[model samples]
Target chain A: MYDDRKYTEENMPKTGILLEVENTELKDINFGLVTAARDTGANEVLAFTTEELGTEAQNDLARYGVSQLIRLRTDSADITSSPDNCAAACVQAAREYGLEYCLGLATAFGRDIFARMAALLDVELAADVLQIDFKAKTAVKSHFSGKTMATVSLQETPGLLTVRPNAISPVEQPATLESSVFQADIQSQAKVAVKEIKTSDDRKMDLTEAPIIITGGRPIGKPENYAMLQECADVLGGAVGASRAAVDAGYAPHSMQVGQTGKTVSPNLYLACGVSGAVQHFAGMKTSKVIVGINKDKDAPIFEKCDYGIVGDMFEVVPALTKALQQEKQG
Target chain B: MQIYVCLKHVPDTAANITLKGQADYEAGAVKFVANPYDEYAVEEAVQLVEKDGSGEVVLVTLGPSEAVTTLRSSLAMGATRGLLVKTDEKFCDSKTTARALHAAILQDGSPDLIFTGKVAVDTEGSQTPYRLARLFDLPVANEVSALAINDGSAVAERELGAGNREVLEMKTPCVIGTTKGLNEPRYPKFPDIMKAKKKEIKELALADLDPALDPRPNLGKLEPVPERSGATMMEGSVEESVAQLIRTLKEGKML
Candidate 1:
């Protein structure tokens, strides 16, 4: 635990990053969040985890300037069973650690808990921010389908922020670490009855956190045809997405949608296959660093917006792209 | 089935937007509507009451006075009435938004369930429903694509992304943050629209909720995201294009 008594400097606020677990292992996205929570050398980073990290994981966090590992738990209830339960645990940690700022990824699970924590603490919350100014207690986030960037200034102590995944790359700065467990005390009454979590069969990576994304649009035509993009996405170490038209046509589910109404992504590389690149669709992936558009129509709007374009049928290009990427990997 | 569906008046998602200055988007001539996701929540609640044959589905919102116009659209879809917590400020913080709605709901007494859209379209906060759930001490589920209320509990199938669903069980008097695919919202008929305009819309001030409220978050500059330059088109066959794409990926260290 960071002793606030030892260093009461006004500039050095206590910062905490909520670590996430995927398939029972630490998620890579936490490294960027931890690096950000370090406040560019302004904060002593604290990593809050539900379960105790192994020596190797602790070492990994230490390299990113995480000085302390706090294993949040409750003696009265299980935190992992439900989001509210996890939130309650985090709330107790915020108070216990005297956290001035708390950060987490803006993924689905992160959104569930941080909002709960904000309400429980009666503090202002900022979700899915793209950039943070820790000293000012402010963040810059996109609004109105990523068309505008709004900087929100939070006033409350322990200001909560759920950062967009991959918004920042991980930076290494080694620090000695202290590991501790915080047992939260709370009432025994359970509000939510958390049941089974049905995991996906083919899609293992979360779209928002995926470094690369390959999306299918209207011309993909069939639900089964998404497999072609999936093959390409796999070779690229990425995830698959669908435009609003594809999802609306029932060729894909709303969960896979990437558009004005769907999930906004900021992947490093975005491949738009057969997507017409409507304003709504472009709004979602606008922040991507590099975009490649593949469409049969040479005049597709995506061609004008993307960094690279190929006028070809996705059916022919996607499979060939997948094979090429695979061979590049082997060679 | 006493249900409350929280609503937000927002600019249409597909509307062209221009900013006046910091945190201010020029609202002039922009077609405002009931938030798209909130429409799904209102739809679910109305369908539940319609199926039960006897119940009230109240619509609650916190925004400017003009928000009632948006609220009436939900009323046309068959809500019992509307509660408008008026705020002149266009970009009110979520904390203030949630607290006001919590207070306003208790005015009519606690209902059996509280429903909200998973996200507000303009802000895309995705926080109100969860914050309200915490303030009300209720179990909440966000991004819910499918929901069934039965025997004092809800069996909600929440979308967990990447084609997975979480089947959760929350007891009655809980909160549900509904999203797209939850249900198809009904368009109000001409007769229903006329009837909705006549429906009661009770108004309240922000101060009425809490006399000495906490300081709210403020939004700074609203600037447009810079546009991307035009693409570098690749010519020749599929194999050639694929090769060029691979070469670019390798050069950029993206492979």
Candidate 2:
């Protein structure tokens, strides 16, 4: 059902990826974005960044088939602090490079910039898209919190797409990397200026980016019981999450809640402890490579959805699993 | 000062959303509620107006006549009045919707501020506020978790994911798309609900607004997500299960 024809270099579409940077380092999510762009059968994949690309960033992006790295710079305004200015610069770059498609990860920053770019270019934007077919100028996105999926086609040129993070897996296709700097001469008309950025003091990995995640449900009687899951999470280098029921019960904050109304996570391994396997919670983590459910009820819905199931009290199963992993590490 | 807050009626978050056909949903069993994120915007607008002790919070929506129910709910929560841009179109893209809203706002006299949810729960398109901002040539701050308004300027904080936030300052006459954690929305009292029924709801048609606007980004096909099946149920003690899981993960080089 998918198009398998390969495009020759002469007629290939040029795809530009808006690279994200955090703490002067490139985010690993960009590699996946680069791969997604290349998967569109683009002849040339370009990485656009407001930050200075070091050797490591260049090496990493090149491994994902990014052929060109363009540093978008402007003396008129601080692109990092002004989203309008940043988007203006990106639009200028896209125009100058004759880009047919511009892709970005659908994080807060990407959503902000791409919205502005779409407006400035007077083009249509597909936000939080799951799949894109560049040749057809079409994309598929989830509607109603993922209950329904819609395929939308952009008739306008320079199709702008913001892909949900982790929606696409990264693939390695080494390319010869060439770098250049583009200084956009656009004037900034931004009324909003970012004055400060505050990072949370808690150093735990973000649930969305964690390799492994252990989530608790309503069965977690009290907030203190989360400590047991935290122990297992620490040993596995994962993050601790809670179901919507747990959050509604005031056992955890919304930031740590995983469900249709909360954060959507795609991890390598998801351990659902005492969860009833409500569709709401399952929708958020169904993309996990492996789902393991621990519940005392043999008929719990989670068991049917999980790769591995254990019919036991979470109070008994969680601690035993933590201890076993700890001993295994020590041995 | 005047504030315009855009609202959308969406299916309840817990409701089971079923597809009726390729491009529509079965609304028979689903209950519609005010978009949760938009409630934050309405609450923020009400708080800002109440803080100033003078001003009006006008609710606006672009949908069918049934959307008036959503506007009434917002009015019950303390909005001054509402404007419903009634459209017969089954679906309107963000850009077209923004243009219609822009025309309506201009017809009502440009307000000092505009508020909308960061994204609609139904469509999940987080573009209306930004598109409106651009069409009106106004500055905007989206996904604002915290907000403060002063004489002619405002300061807002946007969550940047991963527990980071950026503090931003923008002038009035700008658009702000509110996110969660901005403020708790208050439930309307019985008396207010009764009064909201009588409040004025001015309905306008798309043709009544700027006729130049046309919907773009046409929808092609819609299909239900395929079901995921085939999960193996482990049969063993807790220790045995953990051991087997670990061994399998190790063999696959996933751990």
Query: Which candidate wins on TM-score?
Result: 1
Chain B only: TM-score of model 2? 0.93
- Which stretches of candidate 2 lie above 4 Å from their native place? A1-7, A222-224, A326-331, B248-254
Q: List the residue pairs that clash in candidate 2.
A: none
DockQ (Cα-based) for each candidate: 0.72, 0.65
Give stretches of model 1 more than 4 Å off. A1-12, B207-217
lDDT of 1 by residue, A52-143 (tens): 67888899999999988988878788787767778878888888889888898998778878888887787778889888987676789988
- Sliding window of 10 residues with minimal summed lDDT for model 1 chain B: B208-217
Candidate 1 colliding pairs:
none
| C-alpha TM-score for every candidate | 0.94, 0.93
| Candidate with maximal lDDT | 1
lDDT of 2 by residue, B1-255 (tens): 699998887788778877776677777578888888999999999988898899999998888888898889889999999999888665688888888888898899768999999988777888898889998888899988899888788899987765778999988888999977798899999999999999999999887786776655377876776655735665577788778878877877668
